[model samples]
Target chain A: MIIGEQKPLDEIQGLLEDAEKVLVVGCGTCVTVCFAGGSREAQILSSSLRMSSKLNGHPQDVSDVTVQRQCEWEYLDEIEKEVAEADIILSLACGIGVQAMAKHFPEKWVVPGLNTTFLGIPVEQGIWEERCAACGDCVLGLTGGICPIARCSKSLLNGPCGGSEDGHCEIDPDIPCAWQLIYDRLTAMGREDNLLELQPPKNWQVSRDGGPRKIIREDLRLISDELES
Target chain B: MSGKDNGYLVGSHLEKMLRAGHFAVTGELGPPQSADPAVIHEKAALLKGYVDAVNITDNQTAIVRMSSIGAGTLVLQDGLEPVIQMTCRDRNRLAIQADLLGAYALGLRNLLCLTGDHQIFGNHPTAKNVYDMDSLQMVQMVTDMRDKAIFQCGDEFKGQTAKFLVGAAAAPFADPTPFRPLRLAKKVKAGANFIQTQLIYDIEAFAAYMEKVRELGLHEKAYILAGVGPLKSPGMAKYMKKNVPGILVPDEVIDRMLEAGKEWAGKKAADLSPEEKKARSKAWQTEGIQVCIDLIKEIQKIEGVAGIHIMAIEWEKAVKPIVEGAGLYPRPEVN
Candidate 1:
């Protein structure tokens, strides 16, 4: 659950004040679980915009449609008919969903309805917090399932930096020291020896630093050129 | 009286009672996103004579539904008071205030100001939010409209004066710090005449909450309608306990339902194979009805409870029975 808060309605209205025919689109993925943008949100926004427009006497023809997953091409295909009719597409998905909507419907203008916040989980009902960073690496085996990249202010790979005081981060007292939590968990599991092992600095090449990344599976690949020809 | 003036007076009286100690009941119905209005109309009709007012939720929880204004107009056309739920998740104050005025013109008198659920929780995650003003400020704006007949911090209204039964929501268990009562007070001071709280299950905790409300002098200031939604099934009970925010489901209530389960002997029937289906069906129906009646009874006992807002959702037909079972009758004269 990537925890995030909805942006104010006025800010969203401001972005598309000029749009005549508005299409409020929602994603059915990460942002939906986090309560930011999903099909439900898209519909709400579409209704709100329509009502707001009528109230203001600007009266734009506002419509709504939701894609199964805005991040994928297949889901975006479902709303191509609706997208074609609208002047602007207001996406209620996360950053990925919004970008995907933009990419799939290049002819229509796409506007984001939610502020993409952080990768987190609903720790309790109605409360969500950050949990992952998708740093393109997994060190949970060594750190007892906590990712320092997200919890640690410094994203320190080796260990806690000098900024840690009494097992709490110096930047914010409310935040627990990520390394301390890791240390405690490891010690509890009787794997304290794991921390003593020297680990090299994480290589950024495999992450977003390497630009757009792609994964290919030989078994899943389709031999299209020969068949199409 | 003009149809418009009658609507205004109805709204005004409701607002006055809301400011007083009178309990209020309000229910919500979502409008279809499309032009079809039959479903919205039918639901509004069923709730018309029962509730103090019906709320046509704009985009509750950010899920798209029918247009609230259109629904409000339909409700008004049917001679029922409609509480227009306006969320700031999709509009600025300029638009919000404008809608207030537009709703007023449409003969829609009641308004429930909300900040709206984050779009992320709905079907959309990447949607931009517009929080130009929160629910508090919106309440204040409505109050200002009533008193000055003008926009807050702006010029006077050039047209007929607009009045609204302004209300806001409070979630007692929403925050760890329990800011609901204090926030309710703030909304009152800002011009909120009534507060509709989130669904509550623990009467003891709610009674304790009322004690705090009395201490804060909010009991005397604004109408506080305890929100109650009947748990139709054991699954609903579990969902409310685990998922719904600011809800406190007591262990005793769960135990009672479980006991009811035993009396039906569904577990034993399940072992018999042939009786399993019948037993399962009987258990679900019995438990659902029992939970509904139990919640209403508990809520009726709480002090300082001005009234109860029963949210039956698609189960509007069960509302009358629940209210009657809880020993409440429609106070047609009150409204």
Candidate 2:
């Protein structure tokens, strides 16, 4: 899942400074699970902005609404009315949600209120750690399920760099060294032979380097009138 | 590809020494946290002729410092060869390539591609990590720049591409130690010409690692420099054993340090004054240097070992003595 955190109140306030009508939109998916830009967070931010703006002697109108999942156009369509009513749409969702909202409502000025961080999942309550780099390729089978691209400080395919000490990364004592974990996991699984083979250079063209990627499942595509004709 | 195809930059004495099979000796210098060129020059000058090359670390341990390129340039000015250490923690490929070009233009040749220490380990725990590519990719990219005159993205270099006697790091003691040599082989295949390993307090473990490296015939592909460092004190040993990851400062070394302070240890812990404590620390530090010198000697006899990389962290002054004691001084004057 994508993890993100709301921008600081002052930065958001600065971005929304000139607006008289502000519409705060939230996402119910990843941001909700991470307790970031979800519905509750949007409401709290709306109230805080109202109180702060009122304190600053220029009270602005604020409205809050949440889409089921802001990344999907169908879910985002539910908030078209609220978005059209506001002077600006402040998306309290991941960066993708902001872009999706902007794409759906091309007229309104859509701004991101959160900084999208990484693709991660909750490691524990109140703690989330990155788990994937979405490198357009995966090597988990060879690495004992630990994603070196996401976890190793260097994303080294064949490491445990010299900095990895005691199963933790040299960068931080708390963050477990991804390579160390891979080595341990591979040893336990008795698949140590998998690591001996050198992984070839990653083809970045399949990753973001190739430019924005899209998935097309021709088999799953609906046959519209134009296609049928 | 062989080292010849690796396209080593001109005038790297370390490369010259390694290629000449003269038991290359290298040293590490962590550019100060502050931006003082004089400090860099002074520290580098300490190891000026003692070691073949000096490694200028890039924000090692994630602490912000004068950039490694900046410090390495100063090292060059001091008439010492500088191995510019580049980490993947802070820069994307564009910035990394740009910096490498800048470093090469400034007459620095040797480059140690590292996956830098995580930001969380440094003062800036909240800083976003920009691991655009891991060190493996970094090495491969450098190799491409040197060998093919092309970027990893397949764009041809306009002109005058940077050539480097590329290097990378190793952790012989990292857990699942059996696989460590295999990891080293991968780095070598990725284009590392030399490898400076993490601190080796356990010579037995390192010897075992070297055995695997030799068995796989990786030693023929890359120069393997065993990293050895002087411990400042028993407290320092304990701190590293507790905090620093991958480094195994064997309990025996710590026991030696404790023995160094037996005079002070016999008294009440609170009875010792600051000066007394400093004296005890001095004793431990002296013993630490002796131990490092001994380790270097033992490592020199190990099969597949190229040389020693003495990391006298912040104690650059101790580098010369350790090298002399270990009989690594009078570094070969490579053409």
Candidate 3:
């Protein structure tokens, strides 16, 4: 799950403070799972804004709608009619959803309701810890399923940093040393030999450091000549 | 002023009397999941004249609940004082400010600001958790609203200034590692007029907690409402023990409940049948109500404790009986 937290109520309200007609759009994907953008949260926010607008004596016409996946074009198409009516779009989705909304409706103002935090999972009921960095590479297979890119405060792939002590990160005692956890998991799996393999320095070029990435499959392409009449 | 003059007493006087050892009763009402006025009115009416004030829960447990403003409005319309429970889960500062304005407009006066339960605890586990501002910031937000009619985000309102009897929550037992009273004192400094604590079972420990609150001189600055809940069943006791954070369950209380069962008595200490165990669990649940009431009586005697917030949890009907059984009566004027 993409674990995200909602922006402060005051911050979100400030984003749409000047709007007369506010449309809150929710996404039903990673953000929804993280509790940031979902139908329920969207409605609660809409009602809150409406109530606040009333309280301020500057009543707003607040409407709420949820797209199956705000990051997808097809899902955003559903809100074209509603988007035209809104003075401001308060997206309760994550960063991707907000960008997608802005992409589809370039002329309309869009504000984010959530602070995109991290790709994580619920460790237990009511607790979510970051677990992935989406570093544009696959390295977990060599690290006992723990992503050093996400958990190692410094994203060190080779070994524990000097700050690790007593299997706890020096920066935060609450955080377990990611390398230690990886070592223990690997040791339990009888794959301790993998630790001896010195990892090459990460290639930042293949990841986000390179220009925006793209993929092309010639087999999936349609011929333009055949499309023309 | 005599109690007969005005039905609704300002929370300050009530807290003073409560700290002086007068028993106090409070109740909670979970808002429904919609904007319909009738449902909100119905629930508020059920609690009217029974509870000192009906708590309008704000997106409790991150579940989709009605806005506190609407529910508080309904309670006010019904001639009952509404304690608006504002959570930092949903709104940013702008929305919080806006709601405070709306709440004052609706004539709702009391406020309980909470750093809400995370989303994973609710039905929608994937929901985004918002803690941009914690409970202390929320208290400051409301106080700012009341003091300047300006939101944290600089939005100005030309209306009657809000005067909320602000409250916050603390768990003395949960974060035992920290200085809990010190943390609570910070909330008081942030403009918390009172505090409604997490559910407490151990009076002796709570009394000790009260002494700490007194040491900080918080007893002079803020009212403290000790939270209490009557376990409806043995299953509920187990659920509370496992699920509710910051709550402690004394083993002796559970053992006493188990001992009260008819099937358990005269049966050998060893070798109890499965059927006997199930029957005993049922009997224990039946005895839990009385146990909680007795606990409340003991809690009322604790110094520096202002009142009790009875969280019946969908059992609002039993509130009157529990309050009466605990040797408390609604102020005559309120009735």
Candidate 4:
């Protein structure tokens, strides 16, 4: 799941400066699961903004609405009225959702309320750790299901560098060494032979280096008659 | 008129030293956290003739300091070679390439590429980490710029390209010790000309690593310099064993420090004066230097080992003694 954290109140307030009738939009998906931009968080943010404005002696209209998934247009269409009525729409979604709001409501001032952090899941309640780098090419099967691209400090293909000590990364002694975990998992599975083959340099063209990525679903897209003919 | 052989101060002394089949000794000088050139010059002067080359660390331990390039140039002014250490933690690809160009333009030649320590270990834990490329890739990039004069993006340089005698760090004592030598081989494949390993205290473990290194023929691919450092006290030994990653200060080394302290206190280990305790601490450091000299001698005997990198750390004054004690004085001039 995509993980993010709310921007500090000062930054959010700066984005909402000189604006009246602000709409704090939330995502019901990843950000919600991570307690970042869910409906509950939106409510908290609305109240906090109201209090901040009251203390500053300049009160403004602030309200919130959450969509099932802000990235999809169909779910976003449900909040068209609230978005149109507000002077500014503060998106609590990831970077994708913030762009989606601006694209759908072109004239409205849409700003990000959350800093989209990483593609990860809750390791424990109130704690989240990144597990994937979305590098486009996946090598988990070869590395014992450990994502060195995301977890290793150096993102080494053939690692545990000399810095791996006591199963911890040299970058931070607190973080578990990704390559160490891979070695342990591979050893336990009796797949130690898998690591003997050195992995070649990663193909960056398949990753973000190629440019902004897109996916098309030919099976699900509506076919135009002219094109079909 | 290649950048590798020309326009570089000291003319790649380390490369010359290693290629001449001489045991090369290098030292490390962490740039002071404060922007004080005097401190760097003083330390550089101390290590000027003691070691073949001195490494200027880049934000070592993740703590911000005077830039390594700035410090390296100062060392160059002191008439000693400097190894400009570059880390991927703070710079993106473009910035790293730019810095390398700048470093080379300043008449510095030797470069040590590293995947820097994470920011969490430093004073500013909240700073973002930019591991745009691993140390292996950094080594490859430096090699490319030197050999092909092309950037990682295949862009050709209009002017002189940054040619470096590239070096990388090796950890022989890291866990799953059998794979350590294989990692070194990979770095060599990536174009690392030489490797300076993490500190060595356990000679048996290091010997075992060297055995693997010889078996794989990695020593033939690149010069291998064993890292040796003076442990200041019994407390430092314990801290390294418990907290410092990739370092194994064996219990025996700690026991030796304790024994040194006991000897200093005349067997009455308790109720010593503050002055007496200070003396004992000095004794600990002196004993630690002896251990370093002994370790250097031990490592020198290992086949395929090129030389030693003495990281006196903050104790710059101690390098001369260790070098002289280890019979490495009058460092070879490989002009």
Candidate 5:
């Protein structure tokens, strides 16, 4: 899931400075699961902003609404009235949601209240770890299901560098060395021969290096002319 | 494609030393943090005529320093062979290959490919690292440049290709110690002409690792130059034992360093005079070199060991003494 964290209250307040009306729009998906930009957080933030503004002699009217999914236009359509009424629309969602709101309401100012961090899963209660780099090409089959592109500190492909020690990375003792994990799994499976072969230089062009990626499934798209009347 | 073209890859003295069946002794020369040619010249002078070659480091430990290529030119001017280190943390493939061409044009024949220390460990913690290619792929890319005359992108260039006696580093005692030898085999298969390992403080562990390496017969594929460094003081030994991973420093070695300071043992700092302090430092250094010398002798006995790579980290003065003490002086001429 796309995890995110709320920005500091002071920074968020600063971004909304001098605005006469503010709308705190929250998302009900990934951000909600992370407890960052859910409806409750938006309501709490709205109350705090109102109190802080009143104390500073500029009490701006604040309001909030939660949408099912902020990334899609259909979900954002439900909050058109709220967005049109506010001078500033603060999005309490991941980066994608904030951009969607801005695109949907092109004339209004939209700012992100949360920072989208990574594509990861919570390994334990209240703990999240990144699991994928979203690199277009995946080599999980060869590497024992662990992603070196996301796990290794250096993302080393061939093997662990000199910095790996005690099954941990040199960057931080907390981060497990990706290659060591891959080695262990592969060895246990008697697939150690896979590692002996050199992994050629990664084709980064398939990744972000090829620039903003897009997928066009010709079969999935329906031309308007072909749609039934 | 392991130098089958013959006539030597770069004909570097270090390469010739290995090719000539001589026990090579390579030294390290750390570039200064500033652009000072004198520092390079001074360090190279200390190592000149004492070892087969001098390795120029590329901002080792993430600390910014004068470039290895720039410093290596000075070492070359001072009548020494330099194995300029190129790390992947700072440059992408284009930048690395470009630098290799330029370094080769400047008479540098040896190259040590590395997956540079992470930026978090260096002075610039906020800097982004560019591990565009790991050390293994780097070795293959460089060898391809020399043997196949193609760039990492598989694009053939139209000029004299950058030919180098490609080298890579090995860390013998890193975790999953059992897999370290297999990792070394990958380097050999990647076309590395020589392998300079990380500092080896625990010989028994390194010997066992070498036994695994020997079982695979990797020693016959590439020259394995064991890395050895003199512990500057007991504090250094303790710090390395605690902080640096993959470096195994036995208690006995640390005890030797501690024993060197026995003269001032149990004395309060307030009671010790400046002269006594100086004397203690000198005593520790002498022991450090002696211990390094002793390690070289023990490492020499290991069957598959080809030579030793002495990294007198920031202690150039110790190189000559360690080399002489190890009976590695007058590095055999390989003409």
Candidate 6:
């Protein structure tokens, strides 16, 4: 799941300096689970902004709304009235959702209130670890289900470079050496020989290196003829 | 090279020594961070006759320096052989291949493949890294470019390939110690002609690693050069033993270095005058070279050991004394 953190109140207030009316939008999917862009967070953030403005002698009109999925166009369409009434639509979703609001509304100025961190799941009560780089090509099978592209500091293919110590990465002790984990798992499975084979240079074309990516599936698309039918 | 038994790959001095069954002696020469060519020339002069060939490091420790090939060309101009080090951390495959062509064109004969230190450890921590490929992939690519006359993209070179005596670094005591030897095997399988390991202070551990390397007959596949370095001071020794991962400096070695500064063992840093501090530092340095020389002699006795890669970064002056003390002076002249 995508993870994000709310922007600081000072920065958000600075972004809204010239705005008269503001709508604090919240996302219900990934950000909600991460407790960052959920409805409760948006309402709390909206109240804080109102109190901060009233305390500063410049009272502001600030309200909030939550969408089931802010990334999709239909959910954004549901907030058409609120979006049209506001001077700035502050998105509490990931970068994708913030752009979706601007693109769908066209005239509305959309600002991101949350910094999307990474594609990962909550590891514990309040901890999260990155699990995928979304590099487009996955080699987890060869690595015993561990993703080196996301976990290894250098994304080494034949790794656990000299930097690894005590089964942890050289950069941060909190991070486990992905290659060490792979080596242990593969060795336990009696598939240690799998590591002997060399993985060729990764073709990054399918990844972000090829620029903003799009997947067009003709089978899933609805053309004008199909819509008419 | 007689052109019959497949003689030297690049005919480099190091390759010739290994081919002639003489224990080769290689050393390192780190380029300065500035654009001054005199730094390269001065350091190259220190290592010219002390080592068979000197490895010009490529931004070692993620610190920016003169380009390895650029420094290597200057080393060549100084009448010394140079083994250029290339790391995957800085360049993509295209830039690496292009650099290989340029390095060869400038008369370089040896190459060392590395994964490079992380940018976070360098002066430019904010720099974006380009680990487009790892060291293994680099070794395979460089070897193919030399032997098959093809680029990493599989396109034919159409003319002369950049033939080099390819080398790679091995960390014998890195985490997951069971896999270190196997990693060396993978590098050897990828066509690395020689192997230089991370610096050693624990002979037991390194010898054990060599046992595994020998068990796989990787010693025959590629020449193995054990990495060695002077300690500089007891603080540096203790710091490495405690802080530097993958380096194993024993307590005894640390004790020896401490004993060198026995005259000021309990003296406070604030109490010592500048000259007294310098005198103590000189004593520590003298002992450090002795320790390194002792290590070289022991490492040479290991069954699979073929040479030593002395790394005296920023202390190139120590190489002469250490080499001479180890009875490796008057390096063999192989044509």
- Candidate 2 lDDT tens digits, A1-229: 9999889999999999779999999899999989998999999999999999999898989989998899899998787789889999999888888999989999999988999999998989999899998998888878988898888766777656666656677656788988778888887898878776766556667888799999977778888556899
lDDT of 5 at A45: 93
- Per-residue lDDT of candidate 2, residues B169-264 (tens digit): 997776656667778888888888899998888888788788889998989989999998998878888998876766878899899988988888
lDDT winner = 6
After superposition, which runs of candidate 5 have C-alpha atoms over 4 Å from their true positions?
A224-229, B1-6, B267-271
Instruction: Return the clash pairs for model 5, or none.
Output: none
Q: In candidate 1 chain A, where is summed lDDT lowest over 10 consecutive residues?
A: A157-166
Writing each residue's lDDT as its tens digit, candidate 6 over A113-151 gives 999999998989999989999999999989999999999
TM-scores for all predictions: 0.57, 0.79, 0.56, 0.82, 0.97, 0.97
How well does chain A score by TM in each candidate?
0.88, 0.95, 0.91, 0.96, 0.95, 0.96
Expressed as tens digits, the lDDT of each residue in A1-229 for candidate 4 is 9999999999999999879889999999999999999999999999999899888888978999999999999998999999989999999999999999999999999999999999997988998999998999999989989999999877877778767877887766678999989988988999977766646557766788779888877777799555899
Each candidate's fnat, listed in order, reads: 0.00, 0.59, 0.00, 0.48, 0.81, 0.79
lDDT of 3 at B74: 73
Per-residue alpha-carbon lDDT of candidate 3 for residues A89-115, written as tens digits (9 for 90 to 100): 999988888999999999999999999
Regions of candidate 1 where Cα sits further than 4 Å from its true position: A1-229, B1-13, B16-23, B262-290
What does candidate 3's lDDT look like per residue over B108-223, in tens digits?
Answer: 77889886665655778776554446567778777767665776665775666776777888877653213467668767877787788888887878888898889889987877
Cα shift from native, residue B74, model 5 (Å): 1.3
Q: Give the higher-DockQ candidate: 3 or 5.
A: 5
Better of 1 and 4 by TM-score: 4
DockQ for all models, in order?
A: 0.02, 0.40, 0.02, 0.39, 0.81, 0.84
**Where does candidate 3 stray beyond 4 Å?**
A1-229, B1-22, B34-42, B154-157, B260-286, B332-335
Query: Given candidate 4, what's the lDDT at residue A73?
Result: 96
- Specify the poorest-scoring 10-residue window by lDDT in model 4 chain A: A195-204
Model 6 DockQ vs. reference: 0.84
Candidate 3 chain B: 10-residue stretch with minimal lDDT: B1-10
